[model samples]
Target chain A: MEEGTASKRAAGRFCSICTQRKPALRRPKTLEQICRECFYAVFEEEIHNVIIKNHLFKAGERIAVGASGGKDSTVLAYVLSELNRRHGYGLDLFLLSVDEGITGYRDDSLETVKRNEIQYGLPLKIVSYMDLYGWTMDEIVKVIGLKNNCTFCGVFRRQALDRGAAFLKADKLVTGHNADDIAETVLLNILRGDIARLSRCAYIMTGEDGPIPRCKPFKYTYEKEIDKYAYFKKLDYFSTECIYSPNAYRGFAREFIKDLERIRPQAILDIIRSGENFRISTTTRMPEQGICERCGYISSQKLCKACVLLEGLNRGLPKLGISRIKAGNDGSGRPDEEPTRRGREVERPILESKPCGTLDF
Target chain B: MHLTLEFGGGLDLLCQSVKIHQVDVAPKDENAKLTMRDLLAWVRSSLIKERPEMFMKGDTVRPGVLVLVNDCDWELCGGIDMELEEKDVVVFISTLHGG
Candidate 1:
C-alpha cells in the first residue's frame, strides 16, 4: 500500500504485494517477490491474523513470551510487542527465559535476552535450572555425560518455562514454534510412533487443559522468514548450536524438512496438515495423566519426568529413568536404591515416556 | 575484483568468527565475468575456516542458507549465475542455526 524501507531494485521488478517499492526478497511460501515494506506488513499482519483467528489473546490479559534470545524468539518478542501496540491489542507482554546453566551456550544467549528486555521495553523474568531443579545443566551433564543430557535439559526447560510463567502469573504462554519446527515435530512423532503427540503437534493452541495454556502464534510462520526479518530489521539475536547435543535427533528431521522446503516450500504446511488429520484408534491404550506424586506436576506415571530424572541424578544412577522401555513391574529397576538426599522422599519407578525433542527452543 | 563479504546468522562461526572480510578475488579467466558460483568456491577455500558443509551442499549453499547480492535475493539476479561487480556487498546468512 505504501513505499518504505531501503529500496532494492532487483531486475527492476516491483513488489508483488504493494507494487510501489522494488522487490527485496522472494517469499518461500508463495514465491512472491516483495519489497521490505510489504514483507513487514504481511509478516506482521499474518501473525496478527493468526492471533485473531485462533483467539490466542484478549485485551488486559498478560501473556509471557518464551524468549531464548535466538532469531525466532527475538523477532517474535519484537513483533508481538509491536503488534500489541500498533493494533491496540491492550495485552500485557513480557519476556520469560530459562537459564539452562550451560557454560557458553546459554550464558551468551541470556545476555541477548536481557538486551531484548531493554530494547523491547518489556519486563523480563528468568528462571534458572539451578534455582528450579537445584542443579544446572552443566552439573547434570557432568554427572550423566553428553549421551542423553538433552533429555534432562529438554524436560527441565519445559518445566522451567511453566514455573517461570506461574511466577509471573501470566494467563498464557507463547513460544516461537514456527511452521518448520511444528512440521519437524510432526515427522518425528510419526517416526517415533508417538500417537499422543502426533495428534496435537499441529494445533495452533495447545495445553489448554493445563494450568497455563500455551500458544504458538508463529505456528504458520517460516524459519527462513524469521531469519530474514531479523536480518532486515537488524534485530540483535544469538545464534549458536548447543555444544552438548549438537547431533540431537531433531536435527536430522529439521534438515530433512528444510530440504523438502527447498524443493517445495508448501511441503512444510502439508506435513502439518497431515499431522492434524491423523486419527488415533479408539482401542489404542493411552497413558493416563495423573499428578506427579513427588513434584505434583502432571505425569502419566507416579512421578513426573523431572522428578524421575532429578532422583536419578541424586542417586548417582543418572541413567535410571532414561530407558524408553516400560519396566512392566513398578519399582523393579534399582529397587534397593534409596534417594541419598530428600529424607522424606520415597523413590518410585517412571513409566516409559519420550523426552521432549530438541528444537533449539 | 574487490568485494565486501559479510557473514551472519551464525555463519561467522564457520569462518574463524570474523564477521566481515574485504578481499580481492580474481576471476578464473580475466576475459570472463565472475559469478556467485565462483565466489562460493573462493569463500569455501579461502574464507570458511571450519565446516564447509554447513555453508554448502554440492555447489550451492545448503537449503537453509540465504544469499543476497547487494541486498537483493540472489535468486532475483539469476541465482548462482549472478554476475559479480566491483565493491559488491554480498551477504551469506545461514538460517539453520539455533533459535
Candidate 2:
C-alpha cells in the first residue's frame, strides 16, 4: 500500500501504438492498447479519413453540425472544426441545434451548446419547435401526454434541423451519429420491418435528394471512444437524459448492441455492414416521395407527419393521427384522411417510439 | 486501502450526484489482495443509492460503462481481475447516456 508499491502495481502496459507511453484505453474497433495521445491521434485521423473517403464535404461548402450539446455533438463540433483547420478542408462550419423545448432538460443542455459555440468559436444557430410548430415539447406533452409526445418531437425536430440548416444557407448538415447509434437503428428497423429505413440507416450520408443533405462523420466511430476522448480532453458536453423518455423502446435495441459489443467488439460495425448490404426486392412497395400539401416538406402522403400531428393538436384531437383506425373515426372526414391514417399506422410506432435523444436527424 | 472513485457521463446521478469520492476500502479477505471485482461490489453497496441495474450487470460494471484505473484503461490490466492499490484513482463512465 505504500506509494512506491502502488505506483509499481498500477503502472499499466505501454501503448501498443506508441510503445513508449502507458496505454490509456483499448480501442474497441482494432482491439489495440493505446496511450491518450495515440488514441487522440488515431481517433481523429480515422474520422478525417472517413470524411475524405466518403467525399462528405467540398471546398468552401457551408456545413452545419447538428450539435445537441451532448458528448457526440460536442465532440463532433470540436473535432470537425479541428479537422477543417488541420486538414484544410475549406469548409465553413456552423453549430446547429434543435430545441425541443423540454424546459429543464433542453434549457440546461442549450447552455452547454452556447458554451460550445464559444469554446469551439463556431457560429451557433438553434431552431425551436415553438418557433416552427408553435408548440414546445412541454405543451405537446401536456396535450398528447407521454404516450406519443416523442413522435411529435422527433418529426418536428427533424424538420427543424433541416429548416435551421437551410436558414444558415448550409449546403450540408453533419450529425454525430456514431457506430453504436447507427447499429441500433439498423436492428430497430429490422425488428419493425421498416425496409426503406433499414436499407439506408447504415449509409454514411443520407437525404441526398433533400435540400440539405445530412452526413454522419462519426458513422464508424465507437461511442466508447467518443466518451473517453471527451473525458480525457475535458470537453464540455451534456449528460442528462430527457426526463420524459424513461422507457423508450430504442433502449432495448441500445442495450442489445451494448451486450453484443461486450461479447464481440466488432459486432457494432458488423450490424451496420449487414444493414448496408441488405437489398430490398424490386417488387416491394416503396413509399413514394412527394411534397406535403400543407407544407412543402418532403413526404410520402398528402400531408407530412408533422402537419397531420399539428392539425390534430390544433383541432383539439391530439390523438387523431396517433391511434389506429377504429369504428369511431371522428367525423372531420377530410378527403386526404385515409392515406394519412395508413401512413401513421406504418410509420408512427417505428419512428416515434425511438428515444428522443437518439433522433439523429 | 485509500482510493479515489470518480463517476461521470450521468453515472453520478445514481450515487446522489456526487462526482467524486475518496474513501478507504479493505479487501474482504485478509490474506487476498483487493481487485476491481471487489471494489465494484463495495461501490455498489456503499455508494450506489438506487438503480443498481444502471451501474452493473452480473458481477461487473454495465456493458457501456468504461473503467479506468490510475488513468489507464482497466482493460489493459486484465479488467475485473486487475489488482487495486492504495491512492489509486478509479473512474467509471457510462457511455449509454444521451448523445
Clashing pairs in 2: none
Show where candidate 1 strays beyond 4 Å: A1-9, A324-361
Report lDDT (Cα) of residue A63, candidate 2: 98
Worst 10 residues of 2 chain A by lDDT: A350-359
Off by over 4 Å in 2: A1-12, A326-361
Tens digits of lDDT, candidate 1, B1-99: 998999998899998898899999999998998989999999999998888999999999998998887777887778898778878889999887678
Summarize candidate 2's per-residue lDDT along B46-79 as a digit string, tens digits. Answer: 9999999999999999999999887777887779
lDDT of 2 by residue, A216-335 (tens): 999999999999999999999999878888767888999999999989999999999999999998999988877665455677766667766766765567786678532222324333
Sliding window of 10 residues with minimal summed lDDT for model 1 chain A:
A351-360
- Going through the candidates in order, their DockQ values are 0.56, 0.67
lDDT for model 1: 0.83
Model 1 sits at a Cα RMSD from the real structure of 4.9
